[model samples]
Structures are given as C-alpha cells and as structure tokens.
Target: MVDQAELELFRDNVRRFLEEEAQPHYEQWEKDGIVPKSFYRKMGENGLLCVDQPEEYGGIGAPFEFSVVVLEEAARMGFMALASNLSVHSDIAAPYILHLGSEEQKQFYLPRMASGECIGAIGMTEPGAGSDLQGIRSRADADGQGGYVVNGGKTFITNGQNAGVVVAAIKTDPAAGAKGTTLFLLDTDQDGFSRGRNLEKIGQHAADTSELFFKDMKVGADKVLGRLGGGFGHLIDELPRERLVLAAMAVAHARGALERTVAYVQERKAFGQSIASFQNTRFTLARLKSDIEVHQAYVNECSGKYQRGEMDVPTAAMIKYATTELEGRVVDQCLQLFGGYGYMSEYPISRDFVDARIQRIYGGTSEIMLEVIARSVLGR
Candidate 1:
C-alpha cells in the first residue's frame, strides 16, 4: 500500500512533469496525431511509466494503487490520449509479460518497457472481433520449425502505430473454437509485420489507434505469450484490471469536467448576474456534484477490491458500465452549461465531450457490460 504522504509526493511529481512537458504541447500533439516517443523516454527518466512493475524489471515495485494515482492525475490534466496510452502500456500490455512471459522474455521486455524505450500494445480487436473474443479470425500456423507463420490483421489497436512490442491474439486451430486461440509477442521491427494507417477519429486524435497486418510473419516458440491454447483465458484473467482502470478513468474524467464547469459558470455572468447564481444552473450543478461524489465512492470501493485481488468480472463490469455511462451524461450536461463555447474546438469541454464517447466503446461496450452483469444476476 502507498502511504498518504508518499502518494502525495508522487502526485506532485507527476503534476510537475505534465505541466512542464505534456500540457503545453498537447494541442500540437493532437494535430500531429501521436505523442512523440521522446516524451515517453522522458517519462521513463522520471520513473512515471510503470510504477508497480517488479523492481527487477526496472519498476518501483509500489502497490497497484500507485498506478491508479498516476491515471487519476493524468486525467485531471485533461490529457485523455496520453492517459489512455500510458494505461495501455502500463496496466494492459506490461502485465501480460510480468505474469505469463518466460524469465528471458520478462528480462528482455520489461526493462525497456519500464524505461519507455519500448512502447507496448495489445492486439485483441479485429475487423470482425470487438466485444466477442471468440469471434477473432487472425491465425498463427505452426511451420514445422520452431516458429509459427502468422497471417492476419488487427484493427482499432491502441498504441498500434508506435508500439515496439505487441501482444497479438491469433487462432492456432481455426476449427477448435476458442480453444484454438493463442497469443504471440511480436517485435514490430521484424520482417512481415507492417503497420496500417494511423486511424482518424472524432476524438483522441493524439492516440495512435491503427491497424496491424501480419503477412506470413514468423515468430519463434519463445515469442508465444502464454500456453498456445490459453489466449482466451489469459485475456479474461487480465480484464479485471483493464476494466478497473477504465472505471477509474471514467470517474476522474467526470470529476475534472465538473470541476472545470463549476469554475466556468461561477465567473461568467448572464442577465447581469453570474450564471452560477441562477437557480436552474445551481440545481443542475448540484445534482451533478452529488452524482460525481456518489460515483467516485463506488469507484474507490472497486479500486480497493481490485488491489485486494477480490475484484470479479461482474463488479468490474458494473463500475465500468455505470461510471462510463455517467461520464457521458455528465460531460453532456456540463457542455450544455457552456452553451456555444462548449462546441468550440478551443474549449476543453469540447474535447472532453468527444473523448468521453469512446469510454463506452472500448474496454468493452456498455451493452457488453450490462450483459455480463445480467449473467451474474440471472445465472442463465
């Protein structure tokens, strides 16, 4: 567990790093369509990338709570793309190596990953597969040598264009259903691995969401991430953490947006009085403040449960679904408070409005979360 004083110090350090290095240039990065790799290396120098990875792997070995603190702070700075990218590298991608990779793999990958010398991505979604893992069509066939020949494509991959290492999900036995799934840790510099275009989106313009193609890409047996047939289970095992981080992001985003909107209304006057003084604005903000506090408490509880290793899929899904849905509603309401300024690209609320839309889409759709929760309750 991270003590309060230590956590406070770490938070302050992260804030300084962002204000000095990230926030000033974020709009340009959005226009550039990616955060430069040099900035990632800078994060490494500051020991901000992977806080909870084992010390042997160049991490600080702090509790997972420390990572949550990083995510919350990044969100507070309104850098959703950077926050999402780091979360994918730290929480989603690195853990696969830490928990499942061979010692050689861990030693080789984790250190560079910790230092941001290597960025990581996970390839789970395909043109055909988004919510359903079993629906993926990418394949990896044994070549009768020590390696396998891979031929498939993945879409909507986070950190896709810039990843040095990617944990790719593939089907080893196409006829065997989910039992045939496998994971390969591929180095992007290898032959036959090519990145597709950096996808354009309505928001998260700074994030490197893209498509990846493997045309007869060959990976040695040593590159296989987990048991060849265990990929589905591997994804399931790690999802609690993924969903938990997304839940934290949802709450943090809502909080930041609410705080900013409150400040905006209080200062801007209308009808010869501050908008905040209007009864309608007060009621709207009052309800939003109460909802944000309630949701934050639930998120905090979920975070504690996760750190204790007691978080289950159902609860993670519940918070992810609830908090993200709440994020959308809150951002929308807050944008309304800004009136015309909310729609302007120069306003932070405009970015928040669009960026919050994806929270329900990725990390499993809100509909998928509801289905998972329904299964638990109905036992069907």
Candidate 2:
C-alpha cells in the first residue's frame, strides 16, 4: 500500500516545483517545442529524476507508488510532454540498465541519469512498426571484432532530439523472428548516429518526439544490453510497469480535467443562471466524478500490486486501456461543459483535450491491450 503521508509530501514538493520552475515557462517551452535541458538538471537536483533507483545511484529508492505520485501530480498540471519525457527516461529506459547492464555500464550511466546529466530515450517504434516488436527493421551485424555495425531508422521516438543515450531494439538475426531481437545501449555522440527534426505532434507539444537514423553506427560488444536474444523477454517483463505508469497518469489527468471543469461550470453563467445550476451539467459531472473515482481505486490497487511485484501483464493492460479511454471521455465531456471557452487554446481544457488524444495510442495502443487481455482470458 502507498504511504499516504509520504505520498502527500512528495505531491506537495512536485506541485511547488512545477509552480516555481515549470508552470511559468510552459508556454515558452510549448512554443519552442521542447523543454530546456536545464529544467531536467533542476529536477535531478531535487531528487525527482528516479525516486526508486538505488541509494548509491542518487535516488531515494522509494516504492513504485512514489513514482506514481510524481506522475499524477505532473499530469494534473497539463505537463504531459514533460511527464512523458521523464517516464521514457526513468520508467522505460532505466529498467533496461538496472536489470541487464554490466557493472561498468551501470556505473557510467545510472548516476548521470539519476542526476539528469544525460537524457535517456528508447527506440522501439519504427515507421513500419509500433507494438510489433518482431517487425523491427533495425539491424546490428557483427563486425568480427567484438562489435556491431547498426543500421536502420526509428520513428515516433520520445526524447529523440535531446537524448544522450538510447536503448535501441534491433534485429541481430533476420530469420529468428522475435528470438532474433536484441537491444543495445547507443550513444548519440557516436559517428553515424543522427536525429531527424523534432516531429510535430498534435498533442504533448513540448515533448521532443522525432525520427532517429542509424547508418553503419558502430557499437562495442559491451554495449549490448541483456542476453543477445533476450530483448523480447526483457521488454515483456518491463511492459507491465510501463503500462501502470501510463494508467496512473491517465487517472490523475481525468481527475484534474474534471476538477477544472467543475470550477468553471460553477462560475460560468448561461440562461441567466450558473451552468452548475442546470440539471444536465450536474448529472454529467456526477457521472464523470463517479467514473474517475472508480478508476482511481483501480489504479491504486494496481499500484499496490506493482509495489508487491505481483502486477501481471494482462491486468496492467486492462488498467492502461480503461483509464486512458476514461481520460479521453472525461476530457471531452469536461470540454463540452466549457462551451466556447473549451475550444480556445488559452483554456486548460483545450490543451487537455489535445494531450489526452495520444493516451489511447502510445504505451501500447488500445487494440494491443485487448489482444493481450484476450489471450489471457481465452487461453490462446
């Protein structure tokens, strides 16, 4: 179970941090299409980069719930781009190193990541592949000197433009299908590695999503993460936690949008009376409130399971699908209550509407989630 008091303290800290550091400059960051690297360094200084990392790595090594607290608080502020960037680093990339990296790799990377000195990203999605890991076209061929020459391109990579290190998935054997897949710890400074323009996105405007190109990039044999053929298994093992993070963010986002809408309806007038006084508005809000509360309970339950190391892939998939869809519905409904104001970009609801669109797409799409759930249920 999550420590309520400790979680509250963490939430307060994140809220103040955002208010003082992030909220004021969010508009500029959105305009720039990326947050400044200095902002991540500041978060690192505050011990916010990876709260669950081991103490030696500069993290508090807190429970996963604490990480969830950070995600929730950040999402509530409409900072999904920033939140997503952090998630890709801490929630997605850190696990690969912590679970499979050698002592040398961990010693060199973990502390920097914990301190936000190096931004991290993962390259799994490609122009032709999203969730189908076997469809990856990137290849890393042995160079006969205990190294590999990597070649291929990836698209829709979060944090691609600013990443110092990337945990990239590639095919070591074209005929081995999923068994042939491998992962590598790639350095952006290496020759033949380059990033394309920061791809314009409809939502999460401040996040640096881009296309990554690797042309004959050379990687030391020591840079391979995990067993040569174990990338698929490693990804499967870590996916539940990733989905849990997304689900927690979705629940928190729904609550934030609902809260903002309630405050707006109570103040905005229509037909010579406050919108809140209307039966339709009240009913709509009541339904949404109930839904959000229910989803929050599920998210909390999943967090508990995650803390205990008992969370399963299917359950995580369920939560991710349900909560994200709920977030989408809640934001749309809340926007409706805003009338013309909702359509205005200056309004929080408009931003929320745009940001919530990708929840169903990334972190495993809704279709993929259903496929996993069905396999578990139908004994497929």
lDDT scores in order: 0.90, 0.90
* Tens digit of per-residue lDDT, candidate 1, span 1-380: 54879888888988888899999999999999899999989998888888899899999998887887788777767788888898999988999999899999999999999999999999999998998888889898999997899999999998998899999989999899988999889899999999999999999899999999999998899999989889989988888999989888888888889888999999899899999999989999899889888998998788788889899989989999999998899899999999999999999999999988999999999999999999999997
Model 2 gets an lDDT of: 0.90
Residue 288 error for model 2, in Å?
1.0
TM-score each candidate. Answer: 0.98, 0.98
The superposed Cα distance between candidate 2 and the true structure at residue 279, in angstroms, equals 1.1
Clashing pairs in 1: none
Residues 38-156, model 2: lDDT tens digits: 98899899988888888877778988787777778879888888888888888889877887899899888989998988989999999888877678999999999999999998999
